[model samples]
Target: MDLAALGDCLGTSSCLIFQTVGGLKIGLLMFLVASGLTLIFGVLGVINFAHGSFYMLGAYLAWQTMALTDNFYLAVLAAALGVGLFGVLFERGFMSRVYRGDVLVQILLCYAFILILDDLVIIVWGEEFLSSLGIPDAFHRPPLFVGGAIVPVFHLFIIGFSTLVAVALWLFMTRTKWGKITRAAEQNPLMVSALGINTSLLFAGIFALGSLLAGLGGALAASERSISSGMGFSVVLESFIVTVIGGMGSIGGAFVAALLIGMTRSFGAIGFPLFTDGLMFVLMCLVLVLRPQGLMGRSGG
Candidate 1:
């Protein structure tokens, strides 16, 4: 453990701010991805193994959208919309059947989708890395000086934007009619059905909404990271860790857990590089052992 790198990260206020802000951005981004996974499980009661594939699809779709239109906003919109549409179709065509099915059945269906989606990505984008996407000029204008620390504008935007999204999601889940209905459906699908609610469509919509979140995360991340064939796999693994730590089916838990993981990794890069990758795993294990429910999740789930 060399303290040199750690000191470099903490030696100056600006360095500390930059690292801290970066951690927030990473955490929020993780929240966006994992929220969808948790939502699907919460409402549909199925562990979607194919969620990562949808995330990968969003990146490719965004790259293609930018390549063709050269518009930043459109690229983001397209990624979310395209993946969302695909999610709807996928849920209707395949996943809907497996609702409340055997765990193995769910896993098998999702695993098959992973292979199919991976092959599709290769066929569409070629087996090469994509790095053409650039930060939008509007978002690249100028860095913000905060508390004597210069922070990238894009980083601030992400933090603020993600906060807004999280708030909006919370509002939707707690206040909206559909949101209330969704919760009802989650709590008692039989009762919801008895009340003349079409649970099948509701499930499909919930699943698509989850896909949309994952897609948006990928699109947002496109500029920061290289778009590639298997980018989603690593993200999905971290997202699973987030879900587990946050509590499965708990969106609020996911948000906080993502931040914790992000900060752990970001600072770990400076002070504990050797243990960076394993830190989250250790955290996950501890949470599992000490509080199996999660930071914000309900017990017996």
Candidate 2:
């Protein structure tokens, strides 16, 4: 090929690769947020409207921790633990009572919690939006050269970290004794209790784990977007859409749906411009109408 043609080909290839990688990163973030909502709704039968509130709490906590210690890594860890603890408290104190209630009641309870959390957040963090938590200055290494493209080191870190988290969650859910017990409880709580398992504790543990995942998602998102109070409502809606699009109880489904949604959003924004968000909703509605049970969801009752 001539020099101009070769350069054009290379540029097209690089752009495609960049878009793919960017979509994957966005998908991973969606998975992180949706996984928790799915688990909480699937296993505990709690809609957990406050799940998004926990995500906001995580971002605020991470911001505070980073300010205190000047360490991003430590801030993430602290945010996870703090939000996880909050989840435990929420489940044990309020949610446990509504376990056997109807979906409407559960939703009402969660909505009340949401109102409380919103006020609490405002009281603590005020109404100002925080700046993006960019990667540490010390770790701003030169981009990696690949063909005619240069990829930032931070992007690599995000992809690696997300992969590690996904693998870790998979291992925890499939390999551990606790994981098996939790799954059993989800399938049949009466049977799990009859088998001598403490169902309450199991439920609490799942809630904590789910909240930790949401917290991690929020902390990671802070690196790209400004932290704000209203962010919780926006992200929670997306997470709910993702949970429904995936099977409510299927982690693999969540992962797949996340990627689909992320890529659709990314391409829609670039290609459709004015109809970006609307395009996402249209896709969601189509999925709901055509495959209500989701791609990986179990069929039948």
Candidate 3:
């Protein structure tokens, strides 16, 4: 065994720290995207294939808005709100009619939406890699050194923002009456509906909220990365992996899985460069063999 190769694989203390921070940043973004997918599945019992398209839509909208207004905050806000509202419309116009249909119908509807949304993006954005220069200069500032490891300020910002959102979501779910009702509906939709709660409105709200989270993820990413068509599809694939590993309809599971995946991706490149791409798939297979319901998922989930 070559010592130099071993050392490179293990990485230095500073390199490890840098990778850890990078993992955290990626995990935060994954959580944001997966949260909505899990929420939608948990509440509506629908596996949304088009959730990622909404994320892509958010990034495009953010770029367009920022180009017009030259305001990063405003652009992000607008993108999230716009995509969320579109979700509401989509649920009302198409999804409501098929809520009671078979799973195939739901899948087809969402898949169709994905195609439609993709074409729309091409029409609007013209299929090029949009530059991220529209984002404010503040986001491109210098990095911070922790124990001699370099950490980008923007990545830290993402981690902090995601943490804050997670906390707020927890408080909302545990403390607010509406949030409590939503949770109850997730567990027992029939009971809630039979008790006079408007299930349609509840479902719409859940879908819209989930879409909003996805959009927020896209908006946050738009400033730092090059945007293009099919971006949503790529994110949705990873989001599906996170949701699967976390367990369908399990928010806490999604959070934990996101971090696990983030760290895996960050370190796998160093430790097992040749197998990094298949690492998650291998992990997913193992998890399935041991616990088909996922790490934090309930039985049959």
Candidate 4:
């Protein structure tokens, strides 16, 4: 507790360790949002500008579900499943037709979806910022102290849950039959079809998975920030930055990029209060200039 000792700690690796942990938390959330975006783009070949809207829906749904059910666990499940089902409908009824269309057209359609979704949210949620779902009251547990720092149980849950999701995704993609077929479709849709795989169903599955990730991210973020109509638009840009920096089609790339960006933004915000919002973009530009395909992306694929 001595001031001199504290100063020494702050000036050395201890400060970096704290920053890294904080950054890792941010990176985990970014991964949740960007992972879905990357998968949808990599597999379905859709720009999906409205991915952030799905995140917004998840937050709103969490608010509504918590109010109705008064159970955080149930609210999270309902939010994820509801958003995922909506994604399935969106993909099948609308995005399916534009699978192989021009990239600009896809972006236009997604942008339109964004407008429609925003209006729908206003109509349903009434354009007011809802308070944080009162997670502290809901959990009512003692804080976990890490090196004298108070850590919220909800954040611990996010870290554990995201890790589980990542592991499950890795196992599914590498060990399961459905995952193999999906990866094949990502590589060569025509070849996959020639091998007797139904690409349509596979695409639908991927879309659902992507939406599920977005929904989880939204639900988790709602615990940190009030649910608002504009939150999606604000966070989506950060998610896009993570996806681009990580690589479009590589889940591993997304994970790494998310952590890097998360740490950069966290430390940058603390060390350089000015331009905190633009730190991630600056890093993205630097990475792109050095490695156009992203940190883990395949070039000319």
Candidate 5:
């Protein structure tokens, strides 16, 4: 394309709107994964290196569930709940001993799990791209239109679902007793434990909840993208980047950073395609230089 064509593409109203919507979708997907990772880090004080593997497992499980039941909803539910249970077992059987252990030990334990889970996924799913077939026909059709630009209903649904999840999380964290205890434990676990709160149980629950969110993200993507081995590794890096940019352990920060990275990629593709991948890191670096603690993160933790 010539400069004139590129200029015209950049100036089109429909093009801009479509890109904005696309960016939001990407951001929402990242938020689903990053939110969980951040929550685990903030509350449990352990960096879950295997979180992405859980995401990959979720997608594979979703594929199998959809194949069996031929129902998209059931597949999603299975993926989330199954992965959550796996997380609980992991916390109880392995992570429990390493809780508050040396950072190196925690990292090694999680890293080992990542390798094990990767092999498990390959053994179960094989080395092929698993296609999503159980999606509703309506999801494939675009019902929304704007200025000659068509927008798929499924994309809109994803955005709506992500919003609902965010709201629900906020309510659970603020209104529920368990949520309150979880948050309080993050600040002072010893005190909470002294007060008769089962801190161990609370940590396990938080870990499971985080795993569930990651699984939900993976299941959501499985409907639109092909599932493959090592898929989680790529997203895990981005999720961590989002966590870092938003402020370690700040849910709201993760959300905002996800959007920022998404928009940067979308717009960068139009304006500076060559730098698209690096742009996110550049933004992250700038944020770090300006605010070491992150945009919303507290100074410590």
Candidate 6:
């Protein structure tokens, strides 16, 4: 395209509005995955390298569930609850022994799991890439005109659903007794353990909850992204980037960072398409240089 055409594209009101909404949808998807990874790190003090694999598993499970049941809601629930139960088993059976263990060992263990999941996916889904899922009947309605821009309803649904998850997560973490105890244990496990509470079971539950969130994110993306072996690896890097930019262990930080990256990618594509991928790295580098602790993270964390 000529410079004149590019100028017209950039200046259009509809173009800007559509890109804005698209960016928000992208960011929220990242938030859903990052929030889970951050929570596990914040409370468990363990970096869950296998979290992405859980997401990959969720995507496949969602595909299989929808294939067998043909129920969108059931597919979503099965993907989430299935991985959550898997999380509980993983935490109790494997992760429990590695608590406060060597960082290298933890990394290696999680890395091994990643490899294992990749192989399992290949065996089940085969080497060929699964086709992109069709938008369900509910989400297949005509695009709505917003500010003179046509916006897909599915995009709007992702934004609204992610917001609801965030709010519900906040309420669960603040208003409930279980939530209070979980927070307390993160800060003072020994104290909580001394109070006659079984911290082990609590940790397992938290881990499962985090896994559930990751699975849900993947399930939601099944229709938007192609399913393939090791699909989680693609978003895993972005999720970690979001976590780092948002401040490690801060869900709100993850949300904001995801949006920042999303917006950067969207608009950056218009001006610097060649450098779009690197823009997020530039943003992350700036954050590290200016605020090492992250936007919302406390110092020394």
Top-lDDT candidate index:
1
lDDT head-to-head 1 vs 5, winner: 1
lDDT of 2 by residue, 155-257 (tens): 7777788878878888988999988887787788899999998888888988998999889988888877898876789888988888878877778788888
Question: Could you tell me how far off, in angstroms, the CA of residue 229 lies in candidate 6 after the best superposition?
Answer: 0.6
The TM-scores of all predictions, comma-separated, are 0.95, 0.92, 0.94, 0.93, 0.94, 0.95
Model 1 alpha-carbon miss at residue 252, Å: 0.3
lDDT of 1: 0.89
Q: Model 5, residue 179: what's the lDDT?
A: 80
Query: Which runs of model 1 end up more than 4 angstroms from their true locations?
Result: 2-12
Alpha-carbon RMSD of each model: 1.8, 3.9, 2.0, 3.2, 2.1, 2.1
Residues 1-301 of candidate 5 have per-residue lDDT tens digits of 1445446656998877777788888999999999999999989888898899888888998999998988898899999999999999999999989986899999899889988888888888787778864456658664678765667778888888987898888888889999899888878889999999888889899999999999999999888888988889998999999999999888889989999998888777777778888989999999899998888899954
Query: For residues 135-237, could you state the per-residue lDDT of candidate 4 as single tens digits?
Result: 7464578866666655666677777888888889889989999988878888888999898888888889899999988998898878777887767886788
lDDT of 3 by residue, 159-215 (tens): 999978777777877899878888899889999999999988999998898999998
Q: Report the Cα lDDT for candidate 2.
A: 0.82
Candidate 6: where is the Cα deviation over 4 Å?
1-12
lDDT of each: 0.89, 0.82, 0.87, 0.83, 0.87, 0.88
Across 1-301, the per-residue lDDT of candidate 6 in tens digits comes to: 1445446657998878988898898999888989999999888888898999999888888889989888877888899999999999989988889987998889998999999999998998898888655567898789999888889999998899999999999898899998899889878889999999999989998899999999999999887788988898878899989988999888889989999998888777776678888989999999999999899887884
Question: Clashing residue pairs, candidate 2?
Answer: none
Question: Residue 119 in model 2: shift from native, Å?
Answer: 1.7
- TM accuracy, model 2: 0.92
TM-score of 4: 0.93
lDDT of 3: 0.87
Candidate 2, residue 287: lDDT: 78
- Root-mean-square deviation of candidate 5: 2.1
